[model samples]
Target: AQSVTQLDSQVPVFEEAPVELRCNYSSSVSVYLFWYVQYPNQGLQLLLKYLSGSTLVKGINGFEAEFNKSQTSFHLRKPSVHISDTAEYFCAVKGDTGNQFYFGTGTSLTVIP
Candidate 1:
């Protein structure tokens, strides 16, 4: 089983500023990590994911994340954030066990313009 944790429940950043939403996980078996963004009244959108290969993974909207096995972390970062980036971010872990997914409470990103 795997459990995900989002360090911050809320983050407020100025427009065009760099932002990071920290995520950590604990698991007994290898798992897949994912960062998803949810817009207001919308379903979650994949921001980035770490299935295998390179530790650094990039995704849409200039978002990127690094997988650190030693630290059990997959933190999401965006060099510059826009008002449109405002949304709820979720950290998820899919365990080796079939269909077992754990999600964090979530972090709300508020971009000030």
Candidate 2:
């Protein structure tokens, strides 16, 4: 079994400032990690994933995260955020075979202009 935990339910920031959103997960077996972004009343879009090789992964829109094995965490970070970055972020994990995924409650990123 696998589960994801998002530390923050919301993160408010000003435009063009750095931001970090915390995410953690637990699984019985090896799992794939992903970060998805969702705009208001829109579908989720894949931001990034950590499959095997690199611990540090970069995604679209200047976002990045690091996979920490010992800590069992993958935290998303962006140096500078925009008002357009305001959205809900979800951290997800998937098992080896099944496509079924476990997602975090969600983090609402409100970027102030």
Which one is best on lDDT? Answer: 2
Worst 10 residues of 1 by lDDT: 26-35
Candidate 2, residues 45-68, lDDT tens digits: the string is 999999999899999999999999
| TM-score attained by model 1 | 0.96
- In model 2, pairs of residues that clash are none
Which lDDT values do the candidates have, in the order given? 0.92, 0.94
Compared with the true structure, what per-residue lDDT tens digits does model 1 show for residues 1-113? 67788999999999999999999999745789999999999999998889999999999999999989989999999999999999999999998769967899999999999
lDDT value, residue 79 of candidate 1: 97
Lowest summed lDDT across 10 adjacent residues in model 2 is found at 23-32
* Clashes by residue pair, model 1: none
